[model samples]
Target: MEKEIDFEKHLKNAIQEERKLQVSFFDLVSKFEKKISNFDFENNSILISDYFYSGNGQKNIMKSLISENKVNKENCREYSTKEGNLKYDFKGVYFFLLDNKPFYVGISKGVIGRICQHLKGKNHNTSSLAYKLGLLRYEYLNNKKHLGKRKELNFVTEVEPVKQFLQKQKIAWISIDNDEELYLFEIYCSMKFKTILNSFETH
Candidate 1:
C-alpha cells in the first residue's frame, strides 16, 4: 500500500514536469509560427515551369536550375555517383506549391537533390510522391486498384505524367540547420498549410 502511494507520487511529479516541458516547447513553436508567417515565399520562390523543358525535350531540372543561376552554386556540395558528380543544396525544409498553395512539405539535408529525386527519380525510394501519383493515375485509368508492391508500377509510362505535373509546380525553401527544429517545423508547416501529400506514417 505504501509503495503504491509512493509510485503515485512519483507519477504525479513526472506528469507535472512533462507539462512544464510541453509549455516550454510550445513557446518555442509559437516563435517559429511567427517566423514562418512573416516569411515571403512568393518573390523568393523558384518556378520549375521555366526550367522543365529544353529545346530538345524534358531536361534535367536540377542542372537547368543551376545553369540559369536560380540555385546558389556556393551553397551546393558535389559528390560522385556511378552516373557522375552531382550537387545538393544545404539542409532545409522545402514546399511544393500548386496555384500558390502548399501541396507538399518535406525536409532534407540536401534540399535541391531531394527535390530532384522527386521530379526525376524512377523508383519508389527516390520518387515516392511521384510513385503515389502514378499509382493513382494507374488506378484511375484502369478503373482498378493496384494490390501489388509499389515497385511493380510502370515508371517509364505511368510516372511520366506525374513528373510533368511536378514540373508545373513551384518550390520554396527555408534553411534550418538544426535537425530537431527542422523536423518539427516540417510537421508544423504541413499542418498549418494543410498540405495534402504529407504523411506522418512510420515505415
Candidate 2:
C-alpha cells in the first residue's frame, strides 16, 4: 500500500518556513527605514523595502504605518506547539510593486494569505488583483474602445499571463492593530502612492 502523508508534519514545516520569511522581511523593513532618513513622515508612517521576487535585483522602498502590537518574542513566538503557529497575527496593510512602482495597497489580517491569493490568481472579484490586472491588459489591447466579443475573449485569455507577470512582484507592509485604522491607512497609502490597483475612490 502507498504510505500515508503526514499532514501534521507538513503543516509544522510550512509554519516554520513562514516564520523565517516574516523575520527576514522585518529585518528588511528596518534597513529600509534607515535608508530613508530624509523623508518627512505622518504620525504612524514607517518605511520598508524589499525585492519583489527572491534573487531579483535591488529592493523597492515604500511607507507604512505602525501598529500598536510590536513584533517580539512574547508576541511573535515561532512554532512551539502541536498547533504550530506564529504568535503574532500577520495583520497589516500591504503594497504590491510592479516595475518598481506601487501598484496596489490593501489591508489584510492574514497578510500572507492575502498575498498568496493574488499570486495564485485565486480571486476573481472586481477588487481582486488578478481581475484588475486582467482589466488593465484588456484596456491596453482595446486602447479604450468599447468591449467586443473578441476583445472579451482576449481579456479572459490574458488573465493567466498577467498573474504570471505579477507573481514575482515584490511587496512591503506594516501592521495595523485596528481594522478601522487599517482601512484608513490603506486609503492613505493608495492616495499617496497613486496606486493603480486600488478601485475605491478616496480623497
Candidate 3:
C-alpha cells in the first residue's frame, strides 16, 4: 500500500514538472516574438542576385573559376557597406526567402560570411541546403543511399543548379548576441515561419 502511494505521488510531481516546463517554454516564446516584432528585416535584407551583380564582371568571372580555397580566402575580407569603408561583423540568425516565404533559418557567428558560403560555397559543409536541394531534384543523387557521406557526393555538377536557385532567393538577418537567446530564437523563428528546409536535428 505504501509503494502504491509513493508511485502516485511521483507521478503527480512529474506531471506538475512537465506543466511548469510547458508554461516556461510558452512564456519564453512570447518574449522572443515581442523582441523580434520590432526588427526591420525587409529593409535590412540583401538580394543575392543584386549584391553579386554590383561587382565587376571580371571579378564575377574570376570568382566562378577560382578554387574553393581562393573563395574562402576572398571571404576572409571584412564585410563592408556600399561606401566601401565601414566594416560590420555580427553573430546572428539568417533567413533564406523565396517569393517572400522563408524556406530556411540558420545561425552563425559571422552571418554575412555564412551567407557567402550558401551563395558560393563548393561543398556540402559550406552549402548544405544546396546539397539537400540537389539530393531532392537530381535522380542521380536520389539513387545514392550514401549521399550523406560527403566523399560520395559530386559537388562540382550538383552545386551549380542549386546555387542558381539560391541566387533568386533573398536573405535577411538580425543580430542576436546571447548564445542561449540566439539558439532559442532560431527555433522560435523556424517554427513560426514553418521553414521547409530547416531541420533541428542533432548530427
Candidate 4:
C-alpha cells in the first residue's frame, strides 16, 4: 500500500472547501461529549477531529460568507492553523427571526468584543438593540447553535445558504466565527437580531 496520508496537509487543504461544512456534527458532538463529560461546545470550536479537519473549516467559512456566488472548489484557497492566525475573527452577518420578523444583518471582527461593545454602545456599527439589553461580556459560554463547538470561522462567510437556510428553516439564530470564537459570535448574532425581532414583535 502507499504511504499513510498526511492528515494535517489534507485538513489545511479542506479549510478552503465548503464540503467541510457538510460534516455530521451531531455524531461528532456526541462523541466529543462522551469523551469529555460536562464539556461545553457552544462556546468552542467544532474542529476537534484530531487536527486535520480543523484547517479546512477556517478558510471555507470566510470564503463562504464573503463570496456572493458559490465558490468553485477548484478556485478555493488553502490555509493552515499555524499561518492563518485568528484570535478574534467574526466577519459576517447572521440572519434570523424572533417573533416572525424578517431581516437582521450584522457583522463583527471580534464576536466577544463586538457583543460587549454593542451592549456598551462603543462601536457605531453594532446593532442598536444590543445596547438596550444591558448584558455584559461573556467569558463563560452557556450554549450556542446546533454545531456550536465545531463551527469554523469561514463557515459564516463561505456558506451562502446558511442564513437563508436558518431563515427558511425558522431557526432562532444562525452564526459563524473563528476556531475559538464561535460562541461569542453566536451571542453577538442573536443579540443583534433579537432587537430587530423583538422590536417588531412588540410593535
Candidate 5:
C-alpha cells in the first residue's frame, strides 16, 4: 500500500522553512545595502527555482556595480522615504494595474481602508483620480468636485462612461511589515512602473 502524505503538514513545514530563508536573505542583503534601499523582494522571490537561483546572478551583478560606485548619501537619499504608520491593520504594498501595466503603486498597513479612501475620495486619496472615477458609486457622485468643470449636470450622472476606461484592471500586492521598508518598496515600484497616478516626489 502506498503511504498517504500529509500535504497540509508538508506545506506548513515548507512555509516555515521559507520564512527562515527569507529572514536570512533579508539580513544578508541588509549588510550590503541600507535597510530601506529599493529591493523588489516579492518578484525576486518568485524568480527562484529548485534547479537554479535566478535572483542570485542579478543580485551579484547589482552588488558588483554598487561596489564600484560605493554606496553613498545620494544613493541612499534617492531610495529612502518616510511615511506615517497606517491607521488600519492590513500591512502590505499594492498595485492597481490597468491593461497589465501599473496604474498606481501604494503601501498601507490597512489595504482595504486605503483602497476605500482612494475609491470613495473621502480621505484625501484624490491622487488616484483614475481609480476613484472607476470605482466611485453612483450615490456618491452628487458632489460637484467629482463632476469637475462640466456646467451641465445630467440625469444618470454616475459618470458611467469614465468607469469603462478602468476595466481590465487588476491588483497585485505583497505583505511587508516594516514601515521604512514598505515606503522604500512602494517608491521603488512607482519609479519602476512610472505610474502616472503616483507622485514619486512625495514618496
Candidate 6:
C-alpha cells in the first residue's frame, strides 16, 4: 500500500491554500491597478531614479530603478476620501513593459491604498470600469481616498496614454508597497526582468 495517505486532508488543505493565494494575488494586482489608474501614470515621461535617496541610498535607488520607473509619479492617492484613521500619501513609480507591445502597467506606491483603486474604479470602486473589464479583484477590505491622488492622476495623464502604449509594452509589473520600504525597492528588479523577458521573447 502507499502508506494509506490522508489524501482528503491534503486536498482540503491545498484548496484552502489556493484560495488564500488567489485572494492575496488578487489583492496585489488590485493595488497595482489602483496606483496606475488613480494616478493615470500610463502617461509618465521622466524615469528619474534615486531622486529620493542620498549618499549610500543612491546605490539602492539605482538598483531599484530598473522595474520601478517604467511608470513614475509624484503622488498616487488621496487623503480623507474614505472613513477611518487613514492618513498616508505616497509618491513613487508604476512599472510597464514596452517590448513593442504594452501589456499591463503596475506600481509600488511608496505609501498605501491607491493601487487598489486602479484595479478596483473612481467615485465608484465597487463597480469601476476595470472591474467590468474582468481585470483585478477587490484588494483591501475597506476603501480609502487621500490627498495628492488627484495631482498624481494628472501627472500620470501628462505622460502618455497607457491604453495606447499597450501595443508598445509586452508586459508590466505593477504594485504599491506599504509594508516595508525595502519591498518597494525590490519591485525595480521585477521591472528589469519585465523588459529583459520581453527582449528574449521578441527574439
TM-score of 5: 0.41
Q: On residues 20-99, what C-alpha lDDT tens digit does candidate 2 reach at each position?
A: 23234344444443432332233223222222233332111111111332232232212332356443235677677655
Lowest-sum lDDT 10-residue window in model 5:
44-53
Estimate, for each residue in 44-65, the C-alpha lDDT of model 4 and write its tens digit.
2222122212233444443543
What is the lDDT for 35 in model 1?
79
Candidate 6 accuracy as lDDT: 0.35
Model 4 local distance difference test score: 0.34
Write candidate 3's Cα lDDT for 1-203 as tens digits: 99999999999998888432433555666788777677666665656776544243434433442442222333333456555754434677888877665789999866765677677777888888887777666656567544356646677777657788788778777767666667899998999888877898888
Candidate 5 local lDDT, 4-105, one digit each (tens): 367777777888883323344365435424432444443322111221122333234334434554212122211211365323234667666655456678
What order do you get sorting by lDDT, best first?
1, 3, 2, 5, 6, 4
Arranged by TM-score, best first: 1, 3, 2, 5, 6, 4
In the predicted model 5, the residue pairs found to clash are 90-109
Residue runs of model 1 more than 4 Å from their true location after superposition: 1-24, 52-88
Compared to the true structure, candidate 3 yields what TM-score?
A: 0.64
Local distance difference test values of all predictions, in order? 0.76, 0.52, 0.68, 0.34, 0.46, 0.35
Model 4 residue 185 distance off true place after TM-score fit, in angstroms: 16
- Against the true structure, what is each candidate's TM-score? 0.72, 0.51, 0.64, 0.21, 0.41, 0.23
The numbered model that scores best in TM-score is: 1
The alpha-carbon lDDT assigned to residue 177 of candidate 2 equals 55
What lDDT score goes with residue 151 in model 5? Answer: 27
Clashes of 6: 36
Tens digits of per-residue lDDT, candidate 6, 22-47, equal 23544554454345344433344332
